[model samples]
Target: MSRRARVLPGFSLSLGVAVLTLSLVVLLPLSALFFRTAELGWARFTQVVTSGWVAAAVRFTLGASLAAATLDVFIGLLIAWVLGRYTFPFARVLDAVIDLPFALPTAVTGIALSTLYADNGWIGGALADLGFRYPWPAWRGFDHGGWPIAWTVYDRIALAPLGVVLAMCFVGLPFVVRTLQPVIEDLSRDVEESAATLGAGRFRIFRSIVLPELAPALLTGFALALARGLGEYGSVIFISGNLPATEIASQVIVKMIEVNETGNYADATAVAVLLLGASFALLLVINLIQRAAVRRGAPG
Candidate 1:
């Protein structure tokens, strides 16, 4: 067929727009980071990024992000499966609500999480009745070993690194769920039915037939969630109590700039450059994986 349809502008025009958008939205800020960081000599940059506090923050940030992203993979797979494969009352509503974290402002999310998990809050109070609590002080106690314990579901998660993981899980959940939903929906039940007919148990069928197909999407979602978790700030600051001990890498940068009278912006940029490099590495790998997945006719 001669002169088949073209829905959009010519390639040159489209490419120009894409480059402009990318430069303004992403490249310019990143360039500023490097430029500012260059002001700090290599020795100074290394000292700032490799300091004891910065090291600790980096370790905790990576650890918490990994833990939260791993948890999200399991939880998201289960939810996406249910939402995509089943019909139930308010199913659509539940599906819609899965993205609530994305739609809500991070500050609002911070406030909500802090309130819900506070000692006197609903979940916290119920957990208290069940003997789960955090030891706060002489106030809000249940007479345990002469120490005053406050109501919290976790033994020590409230205002700790574990709380960072919790906040990350909340904000990053939608990525995993949304990523896997399409894959779940596209899954052919015929293979599963045949496996069942061939005497495969539910678990066996799922493990052998479904998991492999979902694995790629799971990885992509995990990477995405991990990236978001690493960069998280507002919600995590609230849930994690902003303790110096529980500070993440982003907080380290913030403190470096804001904590001092002189405000070490160059030092902070040095640390940020490292983080940005790492996050970009992760995203690059994810993009390659996504492209490979698409080539293999798999849902992303």
Candidate 2:
């Protein structure tokens, strides 16, 4: 009989602890959600998920998340590079500033954004002066100023979605920055110097050499940002104007819960199931694509 070398004692005990923790914290709750959702029946489940409002909320949430994540990648890269590569005044302060969103309460962020974008607020005032209006009309035929005004001011852009995007972007920025900072610091500047010595332009060197290395970390950050944006409720609820079609999926879930307290538990669980599935699917796809890209970039 072969004798096994023991790396550490109490392996069985450790495994038991881990199993217990998983069961109590993650598995149990997720199982409950699944169990509750199962009670809805396939037809009701489909109806809840396939409703037009649900579809619209999903589209809006995903679209906004994608947009925010895309923006985060570039901005995060810049911020990380600045922090990792250069010494500047207030460097530490700037580094700390990047984490403000993490420290801020989401509800506070939402209220602050809403205030800044409301009709009488600073940003809103300037926008209004530039032909935008606040309390934007509810419907098409409200008549802006009587005599059927051709180009109503309030008919212009609304900032609620923009506020949500901004809030999410602020909160999500640090994820990308933190992920990329180490990778960027580890990069060999010698490679870029060699490329430049070989007559490559600045843009060419960055496009060819820098971006590929950064892609994986960037994608990871994008996935994090996208995930956070999808589940975000407090930061989005107040600033999103809480309007149907415009409200996020989380907000919709809250409203559903409020509609019928008795069914709230089951309906809320159902919505959670849907959101969970979507989040899982999106992260899986992004990860797979990133892995494929990384493999393709590797030497054969």
- Taken over the whole model, the C-alpha lDDT of each candidate is 0.83, 0.80
Model 2 residue pairs with clashes:
none
RMSD of 1: 7.0
lDDT of 1: 0.83
RMSD in Å for all candidates: 7.0, 5.7
Report the lDDT tens digits of candidate 1 across residue range 1-300: 698679988889999999999999999999998999998888988898878788768877887888899999999999999999999999989999999999999878878877877666677556656776443211232334544433333454557556678889999999999999999999999999999998999999888889878878888999999999989898888878878657899888888899779898888899889888888898898788867766775555
lDDT string for model 2 (142-183, tens) is: 334444223223322234556667767877888989889999
Error of 2 at 259 (Å): 0.8
Tell me how candidate 2 scores on lDDT. Answer: 0.80
Question: In candidate 2, how many Å is residue 9 off?
Answer: 6.8
Best by TM-score: 1
